[model samples]
Target: MTIPGHDQSSYRLRLEWGPTGADAVRADYAVVVDVLSFTTTLSVAVERGIEVFPFRWRDARAAEHAMRHAATLAVGRFEALSRGDARHVSLSPASLAEVEGVERLVLPSPNGSSIAFALADAGSSVVGACLRNAAAVARWLAPRVADGASVVVVPAGERWYDDTLRPAAEDLWGAGAVLDALLHGLGVDAAASPEARLAIAAWRAADLPGDLLDCAGGRELSGAGFVADVEIAGQHDVSEVVPVLVGESFRDAATLPPDGPRLRRVGA
Candidate 1:
């Protein structure tokens, strides 16, 4: 299973889309991406006190229905906000929180939700890796590979390109950096090369406070008004909560406090 134009020996990094890609994910590791902020936003919201329920972008009505009856906060975006849409809020976690009396969050985004549904059953652990959680996810994944486990780093690519989304280039690059660090024993400084350096320079020029917002995804997120979420997600080695998909929903594997925020139990 060697993907052309990528390193074939170390591990496989494949870019795919549509139903064919979605079908293939059932037997491989799937890292869903929607770097502009849906995945990042979901990670942040779940880290906070909010619960997330992801659905197909076309299933907006179902998400809205869930929000109305289940106290869920419907979060989505296409172009504009619809009128009299009480349950649906902007994809921003901050904006979603502004709505009064909402509980769980139902999210439908252009890329993230589609990727999630596609890769729902590929990896032993379907983890969401973004630039925000790059280091953390890399650290978490490093030890696992020592067991000779097969891993696939799936980037949620744009609808048009097989390459991962530009905003998600950080994750793809970061994943490669992590693998290089683990296998070839490279340090973070060594990891920061042409692209990484350019990313850092961009971050500094933008007056961004941290390295999280420096990536392609971070810039898109900044425009989307979820810059804070990107900052929080970008923090390295913070929460141990690596959300893994079980059946159809995600569960936090990190040993957080009992009262800590978490996603809804798939069965409970």
Candidate 2:
């Protein structure tokens, strides 16, 4: 509920890319966008009625988290392909589509999961949004933000070799896609940063399917033999499921309260 030195006058619907940006915002809710393809994958799984629990790292802890919830562990793309089971899911959105008989899954990602975890750790409400369900997420959030209550749309960008952040075009577009629906479509009276306005402009100008396929994140997924995943991520405004994080698990936003309870900070 608080971020040190949070200037409420600056913006209501703020836009930020990367973990550091997320840390700078003081918001009632944090909507995370990671188009290549963590959030995209969540959108797909939520659509298919699978519960997703986000883990910050793909390690023993992640496996244990899944076990604790009686959920299956989603692996990395390379490992999933090596296993080659129809039920094997991973970071790839396409792979999740083929999985069956699993009601819940633990997905670990370097960017999206980490941001979601941080936001939850800070006791902020969290929602996962992407091109596929931007409009739905906007609709879900519009009525929930009370007057003067802030919301930050965070685009989880890729990490550079030196462990710094890289501004990803796909994430910008994804963040913008949600903002477009949230501000314009839903007609929320929210302020925006210059960077946010720029992102909104980019989203409006983008050809979506064509442009997303050419972006760095899209190309990387394609080159990794996950072309289908790229295509899945590019389908704009197609999904209705809004993945909301509640109690360490993501469920359909419709199943949650209109405005869910905020988390408490650790040891608070």
Please list the Cα RMSD from the true structure of every candidate, rounded to 1 decimal place: 7.5, 2.7
User: Worst lDDT window (10 residues) for model 1?
Assistant: 186-195
Model 1 spans > 4 angstroms off: 1-28, 64-73, 77-89, 96-103, 121-124, 160-168, 171-238, 255-268
Per-residue alpha-carbon lDDT of model 1 for 54-93, expressed as tens digits?
Answer: 6667664765546464746454543333443545565664
Root mean square deviation (Cα) for candidate 1: 7.5
Shift of residue 217 alpha carbon in model 2, Å: 1.3
Off by over 4 Å in 2: 1-9, 262-268
